[model samples]
Target: MVRGKTQMRRIENATSRQVTFSKRRNGLLKKAFELSVLCDAELALIIFSSRGKLYEFSSSSMQATVGRYLRHTRSDQSHHLDQPLPHQHDLQAVQNEAASLLKEIESVEVSKRKLLGESLGTSSYEELQQLEQQLERSLSHIRARKHEVYREQIEQLKEKYDVEEERQQSPTQIQLAEVSPNYGESSSISDVETDLFIGPPKSRSK
Candidate 1:
């Protein structure tokens, strides 16, 4: 199985960072030496540690290599300058597009300001009428929505009132059910049966 590549990043732990720095620094210096010998290539490498220590490798003198690098970088910049720039037509097209976009944005801003009752000096009578009509339509929608909300609130209140009324009347209904079977009978003394005889009279036996 292929081994996973080691992640390339600075180590956070002080001890581990120092250890990794030492190992990588030696490896880099070794690679520079071998490349110079085998490939016979002119090259230079410089490294600085966290302690500000300097380490470097060069196939030739360091000063000569650095000077050559400077010259080559400057020549590249001059070569780029010598090359022809993009066509003027392309540049003009891009400038025209940007100007068109700016004009369109300005027009939209003017329309918005006019709608908000600002910058009305340039607007015509027709434009004012149109803005007024748009505002009326918006107000109509708002009023309709307000009425809908009022109706919904009224319905909610009605439902809550009915529930409360039922709760209050349930106990009265239960009290009616608990009434006595003879509930409507009269309680006055005159309503009772009365008899004048105190004892029973018996006939003589034959």
Candidate 2:
């Protein structure tokens, strides 16, 4: 029959618990010794009983094994001595970048306020001069833009005037052209003579 799996909980009876501890402790020590012998490995084990008694085993001198372990741990720690911890460096770099960004934001805000003509009480002479220069440049650009717009408007008006003038003169030019061919004809001359009148005969009598 298959054996049942052993329950791992604490044995309730004190005697049974003590017995179990003795059996397990001895079994663990024997296994450690066998493992070291078979693999030619260095090993150590230590156990303490509830009554303050000690059980221990080692493949070599206990002191030597402990000293080797301490040295290994120390070497591991020393290997990283030349560089700062990752977390510390990352946090410090983040703080510095944040501070830099904050300063930049503040500078932009101050410049914006100056442009809007606010918060000028604490401005130095140099700062005020810079602000004045900036404003002058902006005004110059605005004037240049205004002049360009005015020139465009004038050009448009001139074009419109030319077009209207051409429209008004076209009919008169056609009429003059049509009458020019008959200017010196006899009929035209007779019509002009008939339209003319002499002084009245009463004037001659007077």
Candidate 3:
């Protein structure tokens, strides 16, 4: 039977305990040495037996390895000491800037909503001024276009009126012949009455 297979707490027999300790210690050291030889890495091992005997190993000089560890610790501490810490004023300034940016974004959103006609409530003086300016510009453009259209319509009506008046004043062929020849003539009296009463078709429509 293998000794490793037999599960027992620390061997009660003193001789067996000593033998096991020696065997395990030699195995541990051998494995450590093998690891150091196989890998080109700095390695250290320190062991103290129950009898207060010391055992140590290093891939390089033990003193040099310890000095290198100490130097690494000192460098880390020095780096931490040299770093600048944030002051209260710096932190407060950053917070204030963040708050101001948030307020500006909110103001822009509110103004956008107001312009889209989603809200119907009181507004600040500045917002009201912006709206008033927009309205004034729009009203000015509308008034200008209305004036142009009114002038065009007025010109067209005036031309129509002039045409109608001229037609009414002009004479018919029978009347023209009568005016030219004033004898006891071929111009019928009924035709003269019609020319007077029925002025012109264009004039009546107007």
User: Please, what is the TM-score per model?
Assistant: 0.52, 0.38, 0.32
lDDT comparison, 2 vs 3, better candidate:
2
- Tens digits of per-residue lDDT for model 1 on 33-148? 99999999999999999999999999999999999999999998898786656696688889999999999999999878877889888778998999899889989999999999
* lDDT of predicted model 1: 0.88
TM-score for candidate 3, please give it.
0.32
Top candidate when judged by TM-score against the true structure: 1
lDDT per residue for candidate 3 within 79-165, as digits (tens), equals 877665668669889999999999999988977787676563888788778887987898899999999999999999999999998
Provide the clashing-pair count of each candidate structure: 0, 0, 0
Question: What's the distance in Å from true for residue 149, model 1?
Answer: 1.2
Give the winner by lDDT.
2
Q: What is the lDDT for 130 in model 1?
A: 91
Better of 2 and 3 by TM-score: 2
Query: 13-58 in candidate 2: lDDT tens per residue?
Result: 9999899899999999999999999999999998999899999999
Model 2: lowest-lDDT 10 consecutive positions: 188-197
Model 2 lDDT, full chain set: 0.92
